[model samples]
Target: MKLREWVEAGDDARLLVIIEAQDVLSVELLRRQLRDMGEVSCSEQQAGTWQLGLLAHSCGSLDVCLARVQGKVAALNRGRAAAPAELVETRLVSAAAASLACAPMIIGPFTLVSQDELECGPRQIRFDGGKAFGSGSHPSTRLAVTLLERTAAELVPARVLDIGCGSGVLSLISARLGARHTVGVDICPDSLAVARRNVERNNLSSRITIT
Candidate 1:
């Protein structure tokens, strides 16, 4: 929906970056580069594939950015022992299509749902990004949540302090798991805003503090 709004507001199109690779280090680097480019969201297509959605203001600019990224990926692959298949693929898709492709992600006992999927149960985490990062799709996010669940289970009534909390997923999770108080701090204003909205959406504003 945000992508649709961007296109409607005069952006050229939304470019979908499809990547199939088993290398975690390479994917993390590429994700960082894409994030630097502009608005980007990552979703795992399957076991070893990742879909990165980016808003393109101009086709020419998109092409140049892709070329630069491909060059960097190629350089990184040169050092690897075995290269993955079809490391990079591109497609221009409408916002509706992108939305469907980037569907809800189930992380541990929690499910990350968007605005459209509001009929979720108590374990659902509703997160709509306003140019903020972390949607419970990345491997790191999933792992972090898994670890949090393990630790939080043992530590009852714990207080959580999340530094650089993007989207406030961890803080929300801590509160949901019965933490006494949760504090999420972030340098990015967009992240703080999104985190606060998430806290309110989950009705954990009393227990979770976003700043």
Candidate 2:
């Protein structure tokens, strides 16, 4: 959700920089420029022939913010624009960041946990934010982590199994829970690479094996 989400559960000072276009990459660049203005979170979905979205930010004023966003959109339209339908139009909204709902998450020591906004046990978990699939988010991985934590004493299976392991992080979690033997497998080489990095970062070489 970041700072780019607005009009849901956020504050009243933020603005939305909405861009619509047929070119996805061009729209993405516009989104990046919006970030330069302030904190931004965006969502995109294909609506018939056009791409629809909402870019969230906290620009100072409506006019000034619109000017900034429009100028950036013009810059993005220069050379890389493709097809006649790919141009984008921008709009500004003075919405608050509190209006949008963002799943609150925290990572610490070596784990990531998500909780309700009202519940604030830990503040932030600084991670490398790598390409790994598990940055301590996702339901299935969280479920598996809970399983690992609860059954640490009863489970005797040396080799663990994680189906649909993104970034091979489930194995890293299993190893963290004291699994003596661990191996992670995945179809995505990038995800595997991410899993491997997580394992090495934790220094669980003797316990965790990732591929």
Candidate 3:
């Protein structure tokens, strides 16, 4: 069934809509259209493609918003050269589903422990795993952590700046790896909020800054 039809058929109060866009322009277009209805998070899935996660409160509102967005995108595609935007997946979830989805696991040089895991062993990191993207589960986040480890090994006391630093995992890792300081920057307010929380949870607030 189509995405709108699927949403229209459901009674879920909260919905997660995952979208894929070939370029930043397309991603921004979708964000602009849906910004008023919900919170939008953007993360790069590959070199040129990006995945957008949008959390909306009501399925009825989403059904209507999506219809309007589809029409706008169609009109834009016909009049401009920007890439097309499309929804890839949708799911029904509770408010804390994102945090509940995160489980303790090892990622590169550090251990990612959920916030509930009180006793953090050596190299264990605690995070709330709120609505932010990085929970150390994604392959991209893992690779980034690994590369940071290798790079930090050669340069102790180095400062780091992480752009689009969802959940501030990389910044936290850099601080743990003996970086003098780290700054994390992200466009999504939800991501920045969670990243700040994680920074505090790990007691790395002195070494890391999120904005």
Candidate 4:
């Protein structure tokens, strides 16, 4: 699940630690070490580089965990003298929804509506912003939705696959637009968790699946 969800669901305080790794190997090593202390989540930032996020319920154990990570990093950078990894505490901010253009987006016959916005018609898509990316505000996602709108007629009763489906927005939209089945796939477990919630929120769980 998203860190924000976990933080809000539990009564205990949660800590989020973010770190930048020099390479994929470093990220893997850091994840393995941190997993012993708490839940570890990693995402690739660029070629050969990655970002690691560690979440824990106990604040008292954070100091010891940080110290152990520092010791490990120091040992790894002993002789070669590469730049040490950067680590910091981070806060989770809730994402807000907004219209893509000047007005509510009109994709084919369906209108995309933000959670805060009132339902416009029967063909409305209710989407809310979440910790996972792709809230339907990004230009790339808008473009994809537009393409799907234009070609929706040709895709009736089709089965769709959405790769790297962050929030499962496209998959939900595809199903609403008449696709018989939609499957959303992502490498991040947190993303899939959010996507599953989103699918259920839209009442399209019968046609959408997140993996």
CA lDDT of every candidate? 0.67, 0.50, 0.70, 0.64
Q: What's the true lDDT of residue 109 in model 2?
A: 27
Clashing pairs for model 3 are none
Error of 2 at 144 (Å): 1.5
- Please write out the lDDT profile of model 4 over residues 70-114, one tens digit for every residue: 676666666755556767444332222112211344444666565
TM per candidate comes to 0.66, 0.42, 0.52, 0.47
lDDT of 2 by residue, 10-96 (tens): 455444444556554554454444444543322234332334233444445556766666667667666753643232444333443
Best by lDDT: 3
**Cα lDDT for residue 85, model 3?**
68
Off by over 4 Å in 1: 1-13, 36-62, 65-69, 75-78, 82-89, 115-120, 128-141, 151-156, 187-191
Q: Write the per-residue lDDT of candidate 1 for residues 125-196, one digit (tens) a residue.
A: 776655566666666877888888888766466788888888888888788777889899999998998899
Q: Arrange candidates by TM-score, highest first: which order?
A: 1, 3, 4, 2
Clashing pairs in 1: none
| Range of the 10 consecutive residues with the lowest summed lDDT in candidate 4 | 93-102
Q: Which ten residues in a row have the lowest lDDT in candidate 3?
A: 96-105
Model 3: per-residue Cα lDDT at residue 179: 89
